[model samples]
Target: MTTFRASGPPPAADPAVVVVTDLIVFAKHLRLLDAARLRGVTPLFVFGPETAGRDLARHRADPDHPLSRVPDGDVVHVPDTSLETLLRGVAPWLRERRVRAVLNVGEVFVEAAGALAQSLGLPGPGTHAAQVCRNKLLQRLAAPALAPRWTVLGADRAGDAERFGAYPAVLKPASRMSSSGVRAVAGPADVVPLLPEYGPGELVLLEERITGREYSVESLVRDGVVLWAGITAKDTNEADTAFFTETGHTSPAPHLTPAQEALLLDANSAFLGAVRFGTGMSHTEFRLTGGDRVVLMEAAARPPGDAITRLWRLATGMDQDAALLDLALGTDPVTAPPRRRARQVYLDHPRGLLTDVRADDVPVHWVGERGRWPDLPPAAADAPSRGHAVLVSRSRGDLLGDQADSRGRSVSVVLDGPLGADLDAVARDAARAVTISAVPLTPAGRTGEAVR
Candidate 1:
């Protein structure tokens, strides 16, 4: 008897990674694609049914979108975004290629990505961490020490809102993002009415309103080790509305004593450990009480949204997107310390039918050098103007609603300068630069009203 080994040439295609997310995230953070390209790895995108439909509509409406160039062959449309469905759908397709890692860039479907990575023996945020990141209730259960007193309420249990731990409580959708359907309830009576806002049978978290300054921590971890971490101070619309929608963010958290910073990091690390976070960036929001106690608001297994990653890149000179790809590819990421302060401020308009939007022509004084930034706001393409770059997320005819959540914000202005620069003043100046005109709608949300 003779033992024989049969072998052939290697696979013709380049090594690849599975990216489980939609196009919106890629459109905002195009550098993630650039990172993959720079590493010479193919990114096979897997879009869920809902995302596929939304992406198709957006592409048909505007073929010039940043992510419109993705080759169709590299795209995979799945029936749904569940872990089992993703594995069953993509596993066979992946068998033909050398898949390196699985990554999720969207707010939802993190557990699906984590489980996919685990099944492939690749690095990810781990199954437990991903699941906890997806659900507010799971987050509370996973890290009770850092979580505020919280109770669960669903459409069927609307009465439980009255038995909540305290008054002036915050009601958050158990598994939603961008602060959608989240509001501050004044009292027990106020809770039942708001229940209708959420989808029927949706779980809601009723937590004691932890009063304090809110901040977010973005950390890059690999193999359970934190490589880089930074704190960002944030301002929310809670003062102007019942919802806690983030209106602004300052990187490096301009004001943090050494002790306070240490406490925040400790709490974040504890939460990650409890959740068994494995790899990738974690965005953890915290509220520091008057007594300096750090309370966890929520955490996500993906990078921070709303271009906070860009702020981090500008403030630290560390391209986290590159680091993220490096982590996925089984390599250590290089990081840099904070160099300058950066802030992003969102602009909102009066509730009405938007008629016109304009910005004063001002020279965009490049703080250090010109063309150094990769993805400046959309307004940057028009002309050099101001110390900030403005990006409008709405059109002239689009209806403007109350600044209740992230979706309601109209425009965004981003600015960065020396640590001593008065960014708040710059932000004010930037806000004044833009003019918004709208027609006042009737009280019934009809257009048969006066033009304002």
Candidate 2:
């Protein structure tokens, strides 16, 4: 899922870092270029469908591709489609290439691919670390002290719910990614119904929703040392806890004091160490209770999910994607962000087919290009229109309290003002302002597209 430019690394090590991906996308391909420049090492892009091994014929034909150009015959289009086959094919290659370490490029395959590759040869966090890193329960158990007071991990729904005593209990799939399957039960009635979906897990975190400020920190770690840290202040939307969408985040987290920040960093380091902080990058999310007490929520061994990498660069001038590649290839990372604060907002509309389009007056960054757009999907359905907006302002204070939303299906506007100004009614009135249209509902009763 990562790619880099042709720049090589320190001492110009040709370690043949392998990028294991099922499909090659453009942004990821560009990131590989960035990685090459930072790590000072050129890596091989290996695409594995798992039925075979490196397709040499394809490389021969397009010899200009980075994969084809790398050390000719180094083009490993590993033909294995399954994890086992991919690992088997990758093991000897690492050994043969004298690969010093194996760090999964990003928070992908939830470390499954990384685990398989590690098992065959080379050094990595291994299977256990991957599992713990991906599963919240195991992560919390691996470092109990770092997490807040937590208990109860089971699937009996009613019984478990009764046992745990009430609503607001957190439930998430053991292998679910993103916010795809995480739910928070606020009361008794919400418990029994979630069983069909959450009932299958051997364990789940029934966390006491600690009232506090939430933050996610990105850390660049190398050989047990946390090379650099960037903090993110989170803004979340909860429609009764079942759907929590992070609407936005501001980095260089303005709220944490020096002492609180230290505690967070120390706790994060401790958690990483306990979880075997191997190498590469990790994004750790935690809740700062009362703005001081830090509780570890989860640590993903990848760059912070979403396009926060750009936000980090704007806020601090650090290229995290490059940092990830640097440490992956055994080089020090560029972790410090340049002076300033920056923010990014993701429009998480209430799920339904994007019935209409509006907001003709808002600024947005589409793909790598910039310009004002119109009639875009409520959420972009494909490439050329990744749903996002980037507002880069040197004056961080000037951006605080700013809010952007699509006003119904016909109007899109961003209200920029103070950081915590009155946006409650603004958000509430959004549903009314935007013409909410109902497309023909599917037989499954789920929302479908209204393709304009």
Candidate 3:
């Protein structure tokens, strides 16, 4: 069959940028939105029904909420979440709005963004690239040499004792993010119960866990070239439990040996290339094993989560959000020289119902000194804290030991300061100053007496 191909001269002027966001969480693209406005780019925001309604409710309830501050005309709502439906709905809207690019800042919206870009002939990393980055099995398959040994098995096979006789393997949904449905399978028993979390025929990855320090490399790529890359030191709850929940992170990781650094750069380059990742911001995680071996964990085509964007700006004087916006608009990304060190310390709390939080004792140097208590949802897990603090210090100190807590109830903090600042000491003092009290939750889901 002969196919007719459409050919035309390029437009003299580029279209505006549109960002598609979701409702699972708050809109994290506010900084990018503001930057686009400052650059005379009135970007339009496309939100799904869930996200748009939630944003409206949140803004109405709290006037200071970022969504409340957005102009009414700048928002558009799409009812469908499926990639094909979303593309069909958005492609016409983009052409109508003269949108030059479609930016997907959240994991849920990446595939849609790629589809939109392809249909609209805009700049993007393509749908296949996004899928490779999203699915763990695809990532491992794409870069087997860089990734640790892993196997993809259906729910039924996940419980096979002989298959996973290798204890200490990590089991997770092939394409899930934010550690959802992720667990450590020390034995066969641990595998069976968690298999039901996946659908009847859903695929899961059983990976041989690499023991070592965990780190994430945040990079900005333009035309398949890594423009800038920075390493962030990560601390997780691995020592005390099988769950690898993140507890803290320090940017421009000051402890990487020369060999480890070399391995990281090499592995990241190889993995990104293997996946055919072309443009936009990416966050690739790695583990530095005892023998100075670097093992690839996974990567995302979007920006890093967990306030890493703010940490990057604090540490390197570069606004990653802004860089992403520029890339979406096909402009040169904003770059800056590294100016200081940055760290994020997540407060750990015992499993319970939070009753009261106090940060009065927190030192004056902490950035978030407004004494605001974090909003505690009724059935929320004590793992991630909403009320954390930020500080900019002058040096790095021995803060790791001081911030360490067996129960994991310490408040999280993000800080940036000069090279010689005693950040460790500052962090220790901040940890000592903050106190959180919660009522223990019994196995029956009832609240008990308050505990500190």
Q: Best candidate per TM-score, number?
A: 1
- The runs of at least 3 residues in candidate 1 whose Cα sits more than 4 Å from the true structure, single-residue gaps closed, are 1-10, 49-69, 154-158, 362-374, 377-386, 443-452
C-alpha lDDT values of all predictions: 0.76, 0.54, 0.65
Candidate 1 lDDT over 309-357, as tens digits, reads 8888777777777888898887899898777778888876777876655
Q: Write the per-residue lDDT of candidate 2 for residues 1-452, one digit (tens) a residue.
A: 12222232334446556665533222333456546645555565555552123333453345443443456544455554456666666655554454544445444454665575455454445566666887887887899886765666554556766777534556655555556555667765776676666545456556666557778888877777887887887776554335555665666676577898888888888888888867667788888887567888777876675446655665555555566666765668766643544454544333343344333234332321111122121211121212123222111111112122111112222222223333334433332333322333345765533221
Rank candidates by TM-score, best first: 1, 3, 2
lDDT of candidate 3 at residue 181, scale 0 to 100: 66
State the lDDT at 140 in candidate 1.
Answer: 90
Clashes of 3: 19
Question: How do the candidates rank by lDDT, highest first?
Answer: 1, 3, 2
Estimate the lDDT of model 2: 0.54
In model 3, which range of ten residues has the least summed lDDT? 392-401
> In model 2, what is the error at residue 441, expressed in angstroms?
4.6
Between candidates 1 and 3, the one scoring higher on lDDT is 1
Candidate 2 residue-wise lDDT at 315: 50
Task: For model 2, give the RMSD to the true fold.
Answer: 9.9
